[model samples]
Target: MNLFDRLLLFILSVVALVLGVAVVLVGAAVPIGWAQMELTRHPYNIVTMVVGGVTALIAIRFLFFRRRRDPKLDSVMVAGDHGPIRIAYDTIVQLANRRGSQLKGVASFETVVRQGQGGLVLTLHMRVLPDIDVAALAKEAQNAVKSYLEETTHVPVERVLVQVTELGDNNRSMRVWSGTGA
Candidate 1:
């Protein structure tokens, strides 16, 4: 929910809490003149019931049907004379993954594309061989993926982030030697 909706809910909750407390105090016969007068009046009771019912409905709406504001790009459009060419976000992700996988040292990788102010931002998380140079590999992957996406799909790539999450055992080796060097 947005800030306004959240603030509204907060205000409603406070008002409901205060009304409930007032009803309890009146029921206990606190002898407050104004409270007793308001509780005894027929119109006041109807107004309170209506306000409470509206507040309940608002709370229910917020709880069940709140809209999310996540950055999910379903498609990208390219301007053209004939018509706009639309490319699916999943297709872009697949292309980026394929380009990144060309790097021999990468064990596994995942690609995520998000819509940004300038254009689209591609993020890559890769598991690579332990012995490989991480800095060089990340840079190469970033450039390659950015170029491929922008060139193929005509989508402006704002940035490409490559995070090396794990180093795999691709370069590891096991050997055993006799104690006496036999």
Candidate 2:
């Protein structure tokens, strides 16, 4: 057991001892004296005293006994007794990479996984095609990643942040949708 538990047990034992002595003195000695006063020598003297002492001893013994706390095998223990928190971090990043690359205006997206105070945070540094709505694309990608992560694991996504890393203008020359802007 730990030092705190041991200290608690010691305190309980001392309390029990004090109460036991008080029980013996009050129940056995005083009552025995009263019996001698009522009867000739002692009417119900010895029996009452023995019973009281025995009962007190038994109660004291029960009081000092304690229950053990559940311990862990690992040296690193955090958030005790909540539940299982075995989250595969790599899997969440992979989901982010895939989602970021799928944006219509995205050129390429790179990700950096950071461990924060709360949990793992995925930071996506995305290279987007120029003239595309970068802000909207970043928001969409963040939402997608958040949804996917919450669905996948228990560690929780503290932050799904996107950084615009670079720009590519190749898609502007495709001329496929020119009828609308003309």
How do the residues 37-144 of candidate 1 rate in per-residue lDDT, one tens digit apiece? 777763465455556566555555544554554434487778878997878888999999999987767777789988889999889999887667789989999999
Worst 10-residue lDDT window for candidate 1 reads: 172-181
Runs in model 2 lying further than 4 Å from the true structure: 1-87, 169-182
- Of the candidates shown, which would achieve the greatest lDDT relative to the real structure? 1
Global lDDT scores for all candidate models: 0.75, 0.65
lDDT of 2 by residue, 1-182 (tens): 78797788677667766666676676565554566786576545555556657666765775666665333221112342686444344555676678767666777777777666676678888877766777898898888777776665544568888888787656656522222456
Model 2 TM-score (2 dp): 0.45
- Stretches of model 1 off by over 4 angstroms after superposition: 1-54, 68-73, 169-182
Clashes of each: 0, 0
Spell out the clash pairs found in candidate 2: none
